[model samples]
Target: MTDCDFLVVGHGIAGATLAYVLRQRGHRVLVYDPGQANSASNVAAGLMNPVAGKRFALTWRGAELLPFAAAFYRELEQRYEQSFFSETPIFKLFSSLEEQNAVLARSADHPWGDFVAGFDTTDPGLPGTHAPFGGAWLQHGGHVAVRELLAALAVEGTRAGWLRRETFDWAQLATSSDGAVYAGQVRARHVICCEGAAAVRNPYFHWLPLTPNQGEVLDVECPGLSSAQVLNRGAYVVPVGGTRFRVGATYRWPPFADGITAVAREELAARLSVITELSFAIVGQQAGVRPAVRDRRPLLGPHPTVPALSFCGGYGSKGVMLAPRLAVLLADWLDGHADIWPDVSLQRYNTLQSVGVA
Candidate 1:
């Protein structure tokens, strides 16, 4: 049997980042992933937006989390010598005059002004976009190439003989007060479940309200439209490379909805149309389940009953912006160097009474 300090399931952004951090901290880490193509991390555009929603509210701890995440990705890029993270401005086109006024008013009095790179009053921001109400260029916003990063991590982990590319069978998992043994082939001091939306089915941590959210995105080839910035108007048009942009993300409820639908395609196309007059062709469509929580914050810390079991999922759509810092915190907690914040700790659910299983 192979002995390790930690066994992390699911190689999505959350698991991958956590595993990398744990390994970097000099722990023996084994990552188990089936490499499902439609997993949320694989399909996500990895957008890092500090301000979100129609109200343009700042993300939870945006000031601290955004910069920390950027530095984390940069460190990884430097270590691996690869280009996976892009630091670009996000041009948020205003949908109406009221929206523009609201942002301006907020910028005048609130801390939102710190994130505003520029604000246009009357002119359309981008060349082909229909920004009648103008837009706001947000600073400290960008994207990470999640798929590439995962592949790079997998390569390094495999090279180190710690990453296993196979399905993990729950039936064969054995756990005691000391640690966990998987299929009697891998033994670890703790087993961290990063199983994204699939965590709802995990027997150990299923009670934590892990809501699976279905999201879809479209890949388009727009020859006429070109910009280094991500253009946003409800749905965003992210520049991938040379005329290829990813137009995405429609949120749908009731998770595990398989396959992409024409309705989503139409909705995305309509959103893109409202954003830009540039002609485009939809080259591909993808659907995945985001492991969102009912409260929309990440779930961290050990299982209520089993100290050998832990969880680090529930990143939702903000995984790209939130995972890196959260991973470090989780690693610190695991190493007995820090405590998990109450807001994100699994104990916040107060569901221990019902969680009698281990």
Candidate 2:
């Protein structure tokens, strides 16, 4: 017999959010974290962009994901009593005349017109920031203080008696006809792996093509360069309060190692220099692997053979916007109230045949 309803491995944003949702559904949950040295959730700037890239196209399912994400964060704020989410605008700095025309043309269309507006030199609202061809203001996008949110949720999870700090030993995990037994540690009706990039190492569901990408970011002190909106040029410059700004994120796949490098640091500095002429000092540098999928959609659902084993991850850089809503879906599926979305289902790999569809 299982001692708990679920055993959630990896307490990152994806895992934490799933655990939180399961608890709300009145399930007994126990979260396990091996304490990796680097985690993308902690290193991420947590920017949720509704419209992305130089082409100024709407992000995948932006209209639905944005609102659902906003409500999720708001509910988290009220429940955790922590102010961590900031609803700010994102200003896409036009790179050239041709780029400017492309975005402007898209903004003049339907749906895109609702969230995008053109702005010239008068905007960006800061000097030294270069936007020779003007830019676009993307509405309904902002940043989340992921580190704070994750920390707060960890505390709440502990208080609620649903968290354990220890490495999950797969060798000790024994699956059965009904559930899983984690040696003498615990028996659980479900074992959900929200292991992020570590999912690549997951034995049960590693067959899924999860491409882990290493991303680097720099936390800098830019005195007198604060802005209410995120500046997006080649790279993003997000204000994190006071004189601190998180400038980031160079995506490098098949990384040689898992730490900050001089090359990445220089690239980030150059990106910051191009977007804003503001002088800044690097406060710190961080690097973490993002759990990206080949198809660019999140991975979800249970193991074909072992019903108790499940997975929910690969939100990639959009974890801030995707995790919350996905968590709800995961919980519903686990409770037999709904089925996992086909797009994200691991069954798509054609490697595992479903026992039966929900």
Candidate 3:
């Protein structure tokens, strides 16, 4: 009997994006952050790149998803009168001649291969390609100023009386046949959990085999670099355009102790040295567990028995590029518009009772 229509857990990117959508749809949302450690979104490099490097495959649903993400962020920028979308080019350094050839060959296969800018220049940087190699240019591959955007939205929501800040204690959550018992607002007809890595702890959906990873990034000072672009060979050095930059998002799987680790910093530092000659100090280090699922796809849909509850998380490292479209689909389903992204929907998993295993 506290208050709220929808009690969204976690204020990270997943929750934030969903909340924004709900608000736009004219629903009340009370987010429960609980003031826990920031999740991956807080410390993410925020690079929304369409072309995946390793597999040389575009992001899953990248064609449709990227446009949604770009438009969504752009709309937010317009509404809030804030500028966070910085369109910069990203240069991917090739590791070997073989990789460069593969990239060039793939470009030939696609008619719109112009997006993949290829260069014959053999030199990229010191400790250059492992073998004779160059790099590929990717347009529309830039970063979101997540920190600034989150802050701006929070302030906007607060002033408009659309948001409340507090820890969401699950013990207080009571589900009825109809909807949910939140604080007092009773704003939403349903509750969606976007709690990132912590979703594993929720009693209702913990069994979903989530593989959480604790990732850390080093905030370094690089004043001289003119081009505000993402440079990658081994580790990515994303320019933040403030004489400061973000580098080395080292991923540590199998859950370890929380907080930044020396090993992670050292590893990141070693990688950063590959591209930059200037010495930079680690001005800041932030750590958060990414909400990763074993399937590597987002977990979406409603709870089996408790139809009033639903969730959308586990986009892993690709949250920036994935969340907007997924949120739209969730909003559509909630608004009774359309059912989409069935692959990651919650309906895929039966309730604990149905499975006979907790």
- Give the candidate number with the greatest lDDT: 1
TM-score of each: 0.97, 0.94, 0.91
State the lDDT of candidate 2 residue by residue for 153-218, as single tens digits: 777766866777787878789999798899776899899999998877777766778889999999
Sequence-dependent TM-score of model 1: 0.97
Winner on TM-score between 1 and 2 is 1
The 10-residue segment with the lowest total lDDT in model 2: 349-358
Residue 28, candidate 2: alpha-carbon lDDT: 89
Kindly list the per-residue Cα lDDT of model 1 for residues 1-358, writing each as its tens digit: 9999999998999999999898888999898998888889999999999888888988898998899999999999999999888999998888889998888898876666477787898865467778888888898979999989998988887788788888878778999999988887888999999999898888777678877889999999988785778988879888888888998899998834578999999999999999878889999999999988888889999887777988998999999998999999999999899999999998888564274432
User: For model 1, where is the 10-residue window of minimal lDDT?
Assistant: 349-358
Q: What's the CA error at residue 281 for candidate 3, in Å?
A: 2.2
Clash-forming residue pairs, model 2: none
**Candidate models: Cα lDDT each:** 0.88, 0.84, 0.75
**Cα shift from native, residue 226, model 2 (Å):** 3.5
